[model samples]
Target: MAISKLRCLGLVVMVTAQMVSAETLSPAQAPVAALDAAEPTVAAIAPQVDAEQWVRQTTSNLSSVRYINQLAALYLANGYAPLWQDSLATTALEEQLQLLALSGVSADFSRRYAQLAHLKQSNDWRQYDLLATDTLLAYMSYLEGLPEYGRGWLFGAGIDPSLPLPSSQGLNHLNSAIETGQLHAFIAALKPQDRRYTQLQRAIDALAQHSQASWPGFYQPGYIRLGTRLQQPEALITRLEQLGDLTPYQAAQLRTSNVRIYNIDLANAMKRFQERHGLKVDGVIGPQTRYWLMMPVQERIRILALNAQRLRLWPADFPSMLVVNIPAYDMSLWLDNKHVLDSKVIVGRPSRPTPLMSSTVASVVFNPYWNVPNSIMRKDILPKARYDRGYLYRNGFRVIRSWDSSEQIPIHTIDWRLVNAKAFPYRLRQQPGEKNALGRFKFNIPNNNAIYLHDTPAKSLFNKTTRAFSSGCIRVEHADDLARILLTDSGVSPQRVDELKARTNTRTVGLSNQVKVHLIYQTAWVDEDGQVNFRNDVYSYDQINPMSQKEEKFTFLFSGENPY
Candidate 1:
């Protein structure tokens, strides 16, 4: 079974590599004419070296052990010739390195290779080769490390036990591209081609250009309410202009007008600023808005770069899928790569954060029963039941002896006071009704975490900006709409969906075709409009190392066993 799975994965990697290469320009088809014109003598320049010994030593010194074999294979593929030498290839490689350094996006690379700015003047061939090798290795390592860090935050320890590491064949393809003078194209292709990645990259570049100047801080003594005149609004206006919220014309107008007054123009500009930072767009300079405004340009650049690394983990395309962004408290459904539905969602609170995992929505259950998890039952229900004997009866909860047992015990028969968390053997299930926690419908996805998407009776929670109210399950505000769409796709008529909703009894409908669902925790991303959006890290996962460093340990509310 393991061998078969390995073979399947190898096939996928090979197909993906071929597709990437097909999309990218090869040596013959590439604008090598321009490259040749730029450096006429590059083709004549070659380095003298023992390729076998060079590969051996380079692989040994590199920390990325996974790519060492591929690097050796790359050297052998070129007939034991050095890929980077005193040629146009080396010049192009150096230009890319400088570009990366200047972008201020990759702190990990820039900090370690601050000397890259001076690499052009280096006369030593050995030093140049080592630097070039390190740069290539670092680039590959960066690509491989993103998925590793992403998996740690997404699956943690309980969901998926392991994530697929970078394969040797994939690395070899990248190495081959580098050896064949397609290093520029290879690195460019490695980056996510998504518009979000491009927008963030542009944003980073813009930030880097302005990093040298100190941005003016707007420190109002008190809260700047809407339509209020400030004692000094020059600093605020200047800051807005620097952040691109105010155009040159608007800035000039503000300077000419009553500068101390917080007019409608300034308020509108503040609202735009607020929207970019993921704050409530009330046009009021609240504490949160002020806090983000005070953040330095360099810090924002780092944040954008971090998010770019996260974007690299996502696939290039999803034909049809559902994406639940936990931090944004929102869900979007896409059909044929176009967003078909956008709805507010309630995710798990910080205490019981919604686990990030990829799975398929297999079935939808209407008028669903809430089989309360052990953690909720023990911590919440038991304590309340102990204090109030009528708690279970009022809440429409029934205690079953065990999961497989048909015997339902009377609530009065159990001694709630004596029942500790570990000793509790009975299963608690809430009957479907107006008060049912799983409100009207549930979308089940097979996972050990027992997490799912469902309707909720607490509809008012969706009105709040930060809706993190559940114990790992997602509460869809537009659950009925989502269910209708799913059912329609499964050959059910709209009238039938309405009829199903009218029914009082629970009904489970298996989907003929499952839809892929990705529960990602991206705190920062670029919207379709090319506007950068930021959100507060609701689960503190943002603090985890973006590199290959091990994440900090955490305990889940529920054990590994499926509680539902």
Candidate 2:
């Protein structure tokens, strides 16, 4: 039901257009001999191999019949592709079965294989087929290096390589799974204990450009170009491997492309690759482009693996959501799963990193009040306030002294700086309007840290990609647009959102429905086209030695718990 919320939002799907099901270590139970006992598969195409004998000999345990049969159905449905059917004579499917036998190397594969074996035996043939198809679809979605959401496959629709594949109307199911919420359930149903449980999804998410076996860096012409670069396929793979992003399938795909360099197929493939990776679909490979292609796959994988862990930090459920991506310096507002608005943002500088956090928009302080942070007060404002007592008033700040023991009399007011030197008690709040630090439309999310995204009087910061200028809080470029979107359901119209912009008088607007806000940081992320994008690890996380981005170990503050 929680997942159903996403489906209500529009979804995009594309089946290879769907994805590749690669086998690995097998299941715990031995291979099923009963499948061989059942009707034998028709004599094999190409090199003839006994399907029944292979099943019986390969699968020793009858309990694994379910998984073995599931594999068979997947092979049969896909026309018995050699990869899925275990065509390699020497290393048969049984290898995976044995690994599942207990300790050893291919534990992830073996477990998946065993699960397949169980499904075949336990469920009806139709049910078995459906389950296998779903699993295979998910696996293929992973293999084609599709994101858990399949953005690549969707973008590939207009791309030349994917042009060969079938196209459909409406949302590309594969690409928009996450946006639509379908992936949440599929991901949740998976056995969390499995090693590949997180890895597969991480790989898919990382399948974007940064993880792809291509050039590295942004493809800006003068700065770093990919044109005129004579890159070897293996070299690209090697580089991606170093980056922790090269998957066996991606490596293989690149190698195959290398065999016929500069050809139309390769050109189209490159174009599709470029398109899926968030590059211009120009069929040329330049230096910056090449650099992106060469980013170590492992690095991209690590980023995605880390990001998946971050997604877990989101509220288990929220009526409405406003999530900010620190790495991209971007923020998105969503009602249900539908996107309301997205904008560029400026977060904190690296030394004063914006702390990852979450809270509800308890109140919307329109026009707003600005309580100067202590550091700014001491370093910037205090000096000015000391030089000129009227400085605070000039900047729209009002100094207030509260009555404590005696209700009638006001506490004695001293020169602001001298009062501070003598440890006087007073809170200075800036009046709402143009000069207010909070600008207009401050969505107040109650938390220990007084942090919230708001508008800024200075608009130039939005143009920079690396906008880490704030002191821990976030500043949005289109604050009013975001505010209107957040309050739309409460009967606040776009007209009102626009009107409030011109009418700058200070006023607070209470929200009928409190919105949820999440401040997140992911160094590597995927775009709508499934292109994997990476930000300069502003925190220098990539440079830190001995730091592993294991999804289970990396903790983030989600709701009230640490959902690592």
**Maximum-TM-score candidate:** 1
Model 1 scores a TM of 0.80
Tens-digit lDDT track for model 1 on 1-564? 122221211211112222323224321122212121222222111113444454555345433233344444554565433445335555555544544444344444564355443433543333334456556666555456555454553222211222233457656776667656676566556656678777777888887778897677667766787667786588788788888899989999889875777878888998998888768888988788888888888777766766665666665487889999888888999876777899999888787778777788899999998877778888778888888888889889999888888578998888877877667888888999998888899999988788899998888988787788888888999998999998888888899899999998999999986889988777777787777788877876555333333432234233323332
Task: Evaluate residue 402 in candidate 1 and report its C-alpha lDDT on the 0 to 100 scale.
Answer: 82
**What lDDT, from 0 to 1, does candidate 2 have?**
0.49
Model 2: per-residue Cα lDDT over 312-418, one tens digit each: 34453565788887767888887876777889888877655676666777666578767665555555566677778777767787655432221222222555556
Q: Candidate 1 — worst ten consecutive residues by lDDT sum?
A: 5-14
Q: What TM-score would every model get versus the actual structure? A: 0.80, 0.49
Q: What is the lDDT of residue 499 in candidate 2?
A: 75
Best by lDDT: 1
Clashing pairs in 1: none
Off by over 4 Å in 2: 1-294, 315-319, 383-394, 402-427, 493-505, 540-564
Q: How close to the true structure is residue 261 of candidate 2, measured as C-alpha lDDT?
A: 37
Worst 10-residue lDDT window for candidate 2 reads 155-164
